[model samples]
Target: MTTHITGTREEWLAARLELLNAEKELTRRSDELSRRRQELPWVRVDKEYKFETEEGSASLADLFRGRSQLLVYHFMFGPDYKAGCVSCSAIADGFNGIAVHLANHDVTLSAVSRASLAKLLAYRRRMGWTFPWASSGDGRFNFDFNVAFTEEQQREGAVEYNFQRAGHAMDATPVPLPVAQSAAMTGTDATTYSLDRPGLSAFVLEDGVVYHTYSAYARGLDGLWGMYQWLDRAPKGRNETGIWFRRHDEYDRR
Candidate 1:
């Protein structure tokens, strides 16, 4: 009754073998790209940025937590939002399990957001997550990192994200349905929701100084969306249409 191609075992194996060769080549190319990312110059971070953590006020360097490297997931929980962005929450769901492993390997993985420390901690408890989440707290940390934007920036088209000047889709008239829906879920309008974007930034500490290494945004974050990586190998393969994901806890509410 299936419409998919029916094949003998031999035929399927032959096709799979051909795909395996391509997959191997892709793996090698991915390795090369990673090496190139590591080779990118690290700019010294001299500007002081403060964060509010569960342990009280902390410096940007402190987030490294004795590790040489730090990976920050620029979470999209703006100061106004009632809750975190659904998409961001989905991406963060995988962080708890990997945090310990990355810590042992000398890389500290934490999430930085514009939300207050209290709000972040409450949400972490709601989601049952223990990964370090810090609040940038009305500081320029998010702006300097290009993950958060201002109302003026949005109005004047001064936003630069993913290393380029780009207009946010949420600004368009008749805002995209998914954007509107997500904004509603966050208890904000589309414009407010769009101000805070999601991204990942890397930093390194050496000789008692911290350096900004690399950052990615937009589709560049695709690889870090753990579900998509698994879905890519599934039969339906991401088969998405108009925001099919939600915060892991929301599914039961439906």
Candidate 2:
């Protein structure tokens, strides 16, 4: 009655054992990649970046909060959007529980966006998230980090994200379906929504100076999306088809 392959217990164990060996190898490779990420050179941050945080206006270094390291999630909440990106919101959900533990380990984790602090706070309350969310509305922090793009860049198809000239689909004559859908969810047009991209950046404060360590974007961020990790182990894997997720709260409404 099942469409999937059915196997005897003995056959299943043999196949699972083979998978376990491959899984172990993948784990070892992941560990090596992490080490290589740490080995990458840190670039000194000379520009003074400002952010509006819950406490008050704070500098990039101030974001460390007495910690030596900082991890910033470049959330896509442009000033014009009525709400945050649903994809980024899903990622932030995972951030809430781990932030306190990371703080205890001498690392500060925060989400930075181009939206106003007031808007961010209201949305944070809406989402019931306690993790620090800062607004980079007054500064070039998002742009300098290559997550926010200017109008000219978008118009000219000159936006560069994840270390390459990108956003072509977003700039197409007819916006891509998924991009348009995501934009609609945020109450923004496709171009306006695409102007702000999602990413993660790492920083370290050494001897009173902040240095950029590493950054990842696009599929590079898959590891950080908690649900995908679980889904990968599910019978149907990701089982995705054109924007299947919502802003945690939107699911119930559906």
Candidate 3:
């Protein structure tokens, strides 16, 4: 009944049927997820968030300009850091080409961090990207999103997360770096703590006001409209996959 290389025609057919059924189950789940996504509700973003751009400070409402929907990519660039977040940077790299299409949907895409406009401009030049990037240098917007903090908050506890080797084993250790140091490392050319978290946020704009519709972090970005996990699963894969990260200075971001 259990021969390694000797299977009846009926047995082979049964195995194939199982595979087909599994595939069908996966498709059904995917369809259900999409339906749920479409049914999700939106929230109002009425906070007084501000952004620092080349033209100077602007409110979150101003970010919409005249659009109906506002999507903010909370880039990691505190005023204390030297550069921006590499993972966030990688995502930002994919925005310029897509901004054209986003504008067509009445949605404007932009990046906000606490880095100064001058620093952002220089880094943008170095990276050879043209997407609209701004700073929250003079505002508490970063803290509002829980991506930033104050001196006291930093002292409480800050265990950076690394995707390459986080929660994979039972004997995991925490890396403790000073708040200033950790914050500074994020925007620099050096590799950062790999096991923190990544997040996504969206806001809705009605009339001349904005509302915090939703905010998602970690793998919550999965299965969204613009999912790109397949590309990272390719043979060459992506830099953030596994223990695969190099200094930004070493990579040809351009």
Per-candidate total of colliding backbone pairs: 0, 0, 13
lDDT of 3: 0.61
- Stretch of 10 with least lDDT, candidate 3: 162-171
Q: Where is model 2 poorest over a 10-residue stretch in terms of lDDT?
A: 166-175
Residue 117 of model 3: what lDDT? 88
Q: Summarize candidate 3's per-residue lDDT along 1-254 as a digit string, tens digits.
A: 75546669999899879988988998999899767855678665556767777767788877775788767776666565566655566667667888878878998887776778898898888778877777777676766665554554334434322222234221133333332343344653222322223455677777766767666654565533232466555645443433233334556777
Give each model's whole-structure lDDT. Answer: 0.93, 0.92, 0.61
- Tell me how far the alpha carbon of residue 221 in candidate 3 is from the true structure, in angstroms, after superposition: 3.4
- All candidates: CA RMSD (Å): 1.4, 1.4, 6.8
* lDDT computed for candidate 1: 0.93
Per-residue CA lDDT of model 1 for 1-254, tens digit only, reads 99999999999999999999999999999999999999999999999999999888999999999999999999999999999999999999999999999999999999999999999999999999999999998999999999999999989978888787765566567799989988998999999999999999999999999999999988899998899999999998999878888888888774
TM-score, cand. 1: 0.96
Q: Pick by lDDT: which candidate is best? A: 1
Candidate 1 vs candidate 2, lDDT winner: 1
